[model samples]
Target: MKVFYYLKHIGLALLPHSWFTRRQRKLEQKFADQQDYIQRRVDYYLKTAQPFTLAPEETTAIADYTRRGFTSYFYDLKEYLHYFPKQCRFAYYFGDETHIEPRHTLFKARPIAGDNERSVIFKLDKRRHFRFVEDTLSFAEKKPMAVFRGAVTQPHRIRFMETLFGHPLVDAGQSNPSETHPEWQQPFMSVEDQLQYKFLFALEGNDVASNLKWAMSSNSLVFTPKMVFETWFMEGTLQAGVHYVEVKDDFSDVEEKINYYLAHPEKAQQIIDNAHAYLAPYQNPDLEDLVCIKVLERYFSLSGQLEK
Candidate 1:
């Protein structure tokens, strides 16, 4: 069965990574052009509204680099083609920055079937220059939503499932050790869930000094988002205590930032003010600011600031 399914979907499965193909190149060009267009539009807007002087090259670079990240999602979706009875739907979305490491599983599902529905969800974490996964959920037309309770993020977990079901692999979701194994009772939380924010916020506020220290220690691990909208400003590093706060060059840490700002409006304002000036020279300042602001708003809502 696995062999049969592999043979069936191999063609579409072999689509090249987004960076190498002609159509992607064309899409990349389109994105580049759009950035240029937006920058000019923004320049016009800013020029009329405020007295600002920006380097053309800086604006172009900012626009070009940021657009590349934002457009990749659109390009990926645009390039998606139906493999007949195997239409691919996003079950989880992750930017290329997120490494889709292999995991072993005990439950098996057909990959062809998965292409149609089973998917994982991840958001691009610009601050970390990677995608921090929110959650991995399974899809079935009739079902509400099912959690993929596996033991870990590994290929063996998926393979275990494949063997269990005797079917070719398609896709998977996150697993909970407590549910899967009796000896292990680890609490599982999806990044998509609201609790993650609360937890992180507590971690940050609970021991500001320690948290800052830890953040600094792990500064090198952070990756800024490739997009202009991200707030991961590449500002080097800050030493708050024994540990330093890993300063991002951009603002991709949208969620954390909103929370931080809400909690410490002064600091947040400082960031917003600085970003306004620092990113002024880069491309599409308005659009980039808009994205970051929107992300902040969403976080506000999630934090119960807005009524749904």
Candidate 2:
């Protein structure tokens, strides 16, 4: 297993740049298809709700790529922004983060939405790859430790994992190209497998951790570093210590925090309960549909396209 893992990484490292480019193109196509499917669903819901009534002239055709094929994640901002109208009242962005200058009217969406101008609106997690767990283990039945499985995309994540390695209460690893254990060949844990643990570590990669949403749905207490990024479900709304345990950005005190939680099981349990309560609303598909409707209505209103 270890040999296979290292060999795979080595093979990729030895491959030419074009190989990765082709692989990325394939991934982009897959993401585009998923986004289109979600857009269809949103359209159906909007039509059913009849959230806004607009005349032909009042119906502003915002350049929405939600149903079109375009790279939303890890895109070239300058190149992508060129496709949007410069002086439009509002342009919707489905990318991971919004990079358009405040002078422009474009807004970011998905994962985390909103930009420096606060024009971006929040939307539910749209990636079809996420595994949504309807059932989660109780805190008492969960493993009394923390676990993280993801790619090592940023240096801070690497440092964080290194600091927590070999800790008695922490069980962490990489899913792809295993940074911490390059030689270890372990299959990526399913979302259900991860929820069995009492504590789940949420770390950033490329953008905010998408797993954070899944973790919130579970009964486990999430321990994360100070987040510089946010997703559709803003992290700011969650109170640290109550909804989750926040470690330093550098994760220097992760061990100490884990020890504290271990000694005070009741306190940790309260945090777990709070997390479950806060995320309960998102579990409903109807609620997500309503959020989609609200986002579109707000966009239309702000863009001056909604009929009086």
Provide the TM-score for each candidate, comma-separated: 0.20, 0.66
Model 2 misplaced stretches (Cα beyond 4 Å): 1-66, 70-90, 103-115, 124-131, 178-181, 184-186
Residues 1-308, candidate 1: write the lDDT tens digits: 44653454455456654422354345435456466644443332212221222233222221122223444343222222221112111122334322222221001111211121111221223223222221222111112111123344344333433332221211223344435444333345443442122112101111011121122222111112221111132222222211121223332343353344345534533432343343343334334433232232232233233332
Residue-level lDDT of model 2, residues 1-308, one tens digit each, is: 54764465456545665664455455445445455544543332222322323344422243332234434221222222222243323444555554543322233332222334333434533443233566546777888788988876579877876787667788877766764467433467887888888889988666677787778767787888766665445564678898889999878888788778878889988887787787765566544543443445444554455542
- Candidate 1 residue runs with Cα over 4 Å from true position: 1-34, 37-174, 178-196, 199-308
Q: How many steric overlaps does candidate 1 have?
A: 53
Q: Please give the range of 10 consecutive residues that has the lowest summed lDDT in model 2.
A: 74-83
Question: What TM-score does model 2 achieve against the real structure?
Answer: 0.66
